[model samples]
Target: MTDATAGGPREVPPEQLHLLTEFVGRSRWFGGKGRPFQVVGVRRLGRLPACADDGPEVAIDLATVGFEDAQEGSGESGQDYYQLPLAFYTEPQDRLEHAFVGHFEDSDFGVRYVYDALHDRLAMGCWLRSFVDQPEGPLRFHRIPGHELDLDTHSTLFSGEQSNSSVAFGEDSLLKVFRRITPGANPDVSIHEVLTRAGSDHVAALFGWVDTPALRQEGQTEDQVLTLAMLQQFLRTASDGWDLALASIRNLYAEADLHADEVGGDFAGEAARLGEALASVHRTLAEEFPTEDRTADQLAELAEGMRRRLDAAVEVVEGLAPHADRVRGVFDALAGLDGVQVQQVHGDLHLGQTLRTVRGWKIVDFEGEPAKPLAERLLPDSPWRDVAGMLRSFDYAPHVVERSWGDDEGAQQRAYRATEWATRNKRAFLDAYVGRELTPAEQTLLDAYVADKAVYETVYETRNRPTWVGIPLEAVARIGES
Candidate 1:
C-alpha cells in the first residue's frame, strides 16, 4: 500500500515560498521554465545528521511541482518531483554565498537561511558520513565488499555538468546526487556495480549508493525504491576523450602540409582502442545480464515507436519534416529484420561519456538517455545503439573545429581534412568493434540507428541551439543519400 496524498503538507514554511520558486528557476537542474508554475508540495524523504549544533542542518526533499500546460514540450508534467538537498542555517556562511538558495521563516525552527549543500563543507561532511558510517534506517547507504572508503577525505563539488551534482572526495571517490530522480534501479550505479565487481577495467568501480524506501507522494510509483545518490571511484587522472580528440583535430588543422594520418597527434589508434574497450564492456554486460532474441514482429513494434517520435518531432522541429519520409524508410527497414540479439547496454555512448586513461579507454555515465522511461532504459537493446551513438560522436568532433573558422580561404580545405579525419577514425573504430566486417544486414541496422540518433539531434538543436540545427540537418541529408 502506497500513501500518495493530494496537496501534501507544507514541508517548507509558507511565508518563504517565493524564495524557493526563484531559486529553482535560476538553477540549471530545474526542468520547468517558460511556463506558469508553483511548488505545490514538498516531501522531505530523508535527512542527514546536523554534524554540528552551531552549524546548518541538512535535509533531502522532493518538491512536487506543477507546470501548467507542460505536456506538449516535457512529454509528462503537471506534478513532477525534483530532488533538492538543502542546508538550513541560522547565519549565512561567507564561503557558501554563491550557493545561497534563499532566506526563509520556519515556524518549527525559527528564521532559517538556506544554501545548496553540495557547496557547504560541513553539509558535505554529513553526506560523506552517511556513506562512511552506513547509517541504518529507511534511508541506507550500501557499498560493495573489499573496497575501503577513506573517511578523512574532504569533499569538493564538480561545477561543470548540468544533469546531476557530483562531489569528489579528495580524489579517492565521487558521489553523484541525482536531481530529477525516477524510482527504480539506477543503471548508473547498477551497471557500474556489475562491471566493478567483475573487475572490468573499462569502467570506474562502484563504491556505494544511497537509497530510501519511504514514500511516493511525489508522482509515479512504478517502483517503491528511490535511488538518492551513487558513489564511485574518481578517475582524477583520466582525460576526457572528446577533449583529446578535439586536440588531435586541432593539431592537424594547425599543420600546413600534414594530412590527418601524418599528423603527430593522429587519434585513429586511440579511437580503435576505445572501440575495443566498448566491445569488451558489451560482452561483459551480456554475460552478467539477461539477453533475448527479438523477432521481426518485435522489431516492427520498435520501428513504430521510432516513427511516433519522428512524427512528434516534426511538429516541434519544422526542418525535420522534409526528411521525415526518408527517415521512416530507414526505420521501416528494421521491420524486415529478425533474430537480433538484445541485451543491457550503455543506453547513451559518446566521446563525452568516455575517458582516456593511462591504462586504457574507460566508459562512464551508464545512465541512458534521460528522456526515456526507466523501463525502456533498462530494456535490452541492440548493441548497435551504443555503436551508433559513438559513431555520431566521432562525426561531431572535427565539425566543431571546422565551425570555428572565420572567412578563411582554406575553409573548404579544412572541411575536407575534417571529413578525412572523421572517416579514418570511424573506420578504425568500426573495424575494432565488430572485430571483422559488418554484414549487409548489420550495416542496415547500424544505418537506421545512426539516422535515428541524427533525427533526435535535429530536434534537440532546434529547441536548444537553433543556429546549430543545420549540422544535424546536413547529416540527415547525407544519411538519406546513403
Candidate 2:
C-alpha cells in the first residue's frame, strides 16, 4: 500500500487500475458490458467529510474507460465515464466486504483497503450534513428557499438502482446521486426543482442538490460543474404502479365469474389517474421548456428515423421480418402530419416509473431514456411517444402475469383474460390523456409512435430477454392492423 495525506486529492496507483476496470465490468450499471475497456484516465473529484479520523478516509473520482482495442476498426465507439466513490483504510472493513474493490496502496495513503463508499454510513453523512450546513469551497450545496433539511436523520442506501445511487432518510428526504458524468444538465434534478417550486402535486418536492466546482472536464465550460447529487422529499407511503398493475392482473385471473372491470383489483381507475398525472406533468414541462411545431421536413425526418430503426431491427430480430413492411407503412403516414405539438416529454415513461400514493399518482424520472445521449434526451419530442410507452406497459403487465401461470389447464383462459385487462386499462388511459375522441390524424400519429416503440422493444428483448420477445412482436402485429 502506498501513502496519502488526509483532506486532499491524489492519483490512484496506475498498476491497481485494472482492479477498478474489473469491478466496473462486473457491475450492472456499467454500460459497456460485452465489450472490453481499459482505464484511460482518472480525475479525483473530492473527499467527503468523514466523522472517523481513525477510520478510512473517503474520496470520489471520475474514471474514463476507453474501448480502443475492441473498437480499433469501428469508428463509433468511444470512452465512458463512471463515478467512483471510494473509502480507503489501513485495515479491512468487514461490514463492507461485499462492496470491497481490492486492497491497494495509494501513493499518498499507504496500505489502504478500498471499498465503494456509498455503502458506508459515515461517508453518506457528509452528503446529509452538506445540505444543512451549505459548506464553502469546491463542493457546493444548494437548497430550495423554504424547506429546512434535517441534518440528524440517518440515510438508507437504495439497493439495485441501475443508473444512479439513492439514499432515503426515513421519510424526510431522498438523495439521488448521479453516477455517470454529464457536464451540461441532468433533467432529473433540474425538472424536479422546477416542479417542486411550482407546487406541483404530481411529483416529489425538491430539497437540494450537491455539486463540485473543482472536478470539471477539460473542454467543458468553466461555469459547468458536475451535478453530484439531488435531494427531494421521500414518498414514504408511495407504492409502485407496476406492482399494483400486476396485483390487479392476478386478481382478475383469480376470479372465474368476474371480468377485468368486475374484478376487485380493477386497474382502469388507476390507469386513468396515472394518465391525468402524466398529462399534468407534460403540461408542466411544456410550460417550463419551449414548445414548437415541427416543419414538414422535420416530420419526414422523424418518420425516416423510425423507419431506419425498423430496418435495422429486422436484421437482428428475425421475428420482426414479417411485420417490417406494415410497420413502415405506419411511419410513412407521419409525413402528412401537420401542426403537431412537440415539447419536452417523459421519453421513457412506463408503469414502473410511476407511483400510486394515497392522494393520487406521482410521476418521477424526467431523465428520459436512460440509454440515449443526454443531448438527444433533452430534444423535444411528441407527447404521443410518452403515451405509447405507457400503452405498451399496460399490455406487458397482464401478459407477464399470464406467463407466470405456465402451460397449465387454464392457460388459454388466462391469456384471454389478460388481453381483456390490458384493453380496458389502455382505453381508460388514452381517453384521460386526449380528453376527446381522437381525430384520424391524431390516431395515425399515435399508431406510428406505438410502432416505433414496439420496434425498439423488439431489439431490446432480442438482446436481453429473448423469451419475452413475443410481447413486442405481438404488439407490432396488432398495431399495424387496420
Candidate 3:
C-alpha cells in the first residue's frame, strides 16, 4: 500500500492488497480486464463527511494497477488508477453480503468489514448530503445553484453500465462514479456543465461533481485534478432509445406484411426527434466551445488514419479483406473535399447513448469512445462523425434483431424488411438533422465517416461477437457499392 500524501490519509495493509486486485477483476466497470496487471498500491484519498452514528464509515480509496508490458508510443505509462468508495463496518452485515469486499485490521479502528459503498444506501446518502453541504476536505464537492436535493431518497446502483457505476437516488438525481481514473479534467463533466449552464434541454442537467488533487505517482506530474464522480438530474420516466428501436424492429417483424411506416412501432418519428435534439446539442457545443476548420491537407491526414485503421482491421477481421478496396475508395474520396467544418461533438453517439422522456430526447455520456485516450476523446471533430455513428446504429438495430433469429425460415424476407426499416429511419434522421438534401461534399464526408464507423464495428464484432460481424460487413459492402 502507498500513501497519497506525505502525511495525510492512511495506507491499506500489505496483506490486503490482493483482495483489492481480486475485487477489481470481478467488477464490470474495470476496463483492464483482459490485460495482465497487478494492484501495486492503494491510497486512501479521504472519508465522506457527515454520516449518522448508525451508518458505516465511508471512505474513498485510489488503487494503482501497473501493467508489465506497455504499448510503445501509445502515451500510456501502462498503469491505471481506479476509484473505490468503500463502506467499513465494525461487524459484517448480512444485508451487504453481496457487496462485501474483505475484512482488514485498521490501526485505529481495529478489525473492520468493507463493502462497496455505492451499494450501501446509507453510505450513498452521506455522499448526496456531502454534495449539498460542500464541507471542507481534500474531496471537494461543487454544486450548481438550481435544484434542491432530497436527502431522504435511497440510492439504487444501475446494472447496465460497463465502464462506470451510476447510482440513482430515488427519481431525483443520479450520481455517475467513474471507475477508471484519468488525471485530467473529464470531458463528460465539462461538456455537461456547459450544456446545463446554457439551459439546453437535450441533456440531463448537471448538478455538481466530485474531485480532488491528482494522486501523485512516480514519473507523473503533480498539481493536476482528478474528477471522481458527477451528480446530475435523473430522468425518472425515460425509455432507453436502443430498447425503443429494438421494440420497433420486433414490431415490424411480427407483422411481416406491414411496411415499416405502417407498423404500430414505427420509429422514424422518434428518430427524427433524436436527430433534431443532437443537432441542437451540436449547435450549442459549437457555440459554447471552440470551432475550427480542417483544411484539405488535414482532411487527407484524417483519411489516411482511416486507411491505416482499415489496414490493421483486415489482419484481425479476415472478412474485411474483400471489402478493403471499396472501403479505401470511400475514404480516398474524403481527401478530395476542399475543407470541412469541425466542432466539439459527442465523440461517440448512438442509440444506446440516448433517452426518450416526456419532454424530449436527451443525450447522455459525453465521455467519447472508451478505447481512446482522454486527450483524444476531448479533441474537436466534425459533427458528421456523430451523424455517422447514429447512422451506423440505425443500421445495427434491425440487423442485431435479425441476427438473433439464426437460420430461421423466411430469412430472405426478414432481410428485405430489415433493410426497409433501416433505410426509412436513417433517411428520417439524416433529413431532420441537415434539413435538406445532402450536397455532394456533405455526402462524401458522411459516407466516409459511416464507412469508418462500420470498419470499427467490424473489428469489434469480429473480436467479441463473430456472428454479428456480418452486420457491419453488409454496411461496408453497400458503402463500397455506392
Candidate 1 lDDT by residue in tens digits, 1-482: 12233123555665556677777777777767777877766776666766656768877777767777767766576666677888889887888898998887754346788898888878888888777666655567887877787768788988775688889999888989898877777889888999998899999899899887765544765436778899888898899999999999999999968999999999999999999999999999999999999999999998888888888888988667888888888898887898899999998899999998888999999989887867789889999999999998998899888888765899889988988898899999999999998997798789889988888888998989887776677778777575
- 1-482: candidate 3 lDDT, tens digit per residue: 22235213356666788888888889999888788887887767777764787898888888888877778797766888899999989888999998889999755347899999989998999999998777677788999989999888999999995689999999999999999988778999999999999999999999999988846645865756788999999999899999999999999999988999999999999999998999999999999998888999999999999999999999999778888998899899998887688988998899999999999999999999877778888888999999999999999999989877877787988999999999999999999999988899889999999999999889999999998899998998888575
Q: Which candidate would rank higher by TM-score, 2 or 3?
A: 3
After superposing candidate 2, which stretches have Cα over 4 Å from the reference?
1-10, 52-56, 68-76, 107-110, 214-223
Candidate number with greatest TM-score: 3
The alpha-carbon lDDT assigned to residue 409 of candidate 2 equals 81
Q: Top lDDT: which candidate number?
A: 3
| Candidate 3 wrongly placed segments (more than 4 Å) | 1-11, 69-77, 107-109
Q: Rank the candidates by lDDT, best first.
A: 3, 1, 2
Give residue 33's error in model 2 in angstroms.
Answer: 2.4
Model 2's alpha-carbon lDDT is: 0.81
In the predicted model 1, the residue pairs found to clash are none
Error of 3 at 228 (Å): 0.6
How many clashes would you count in candidate 1?
A: 0
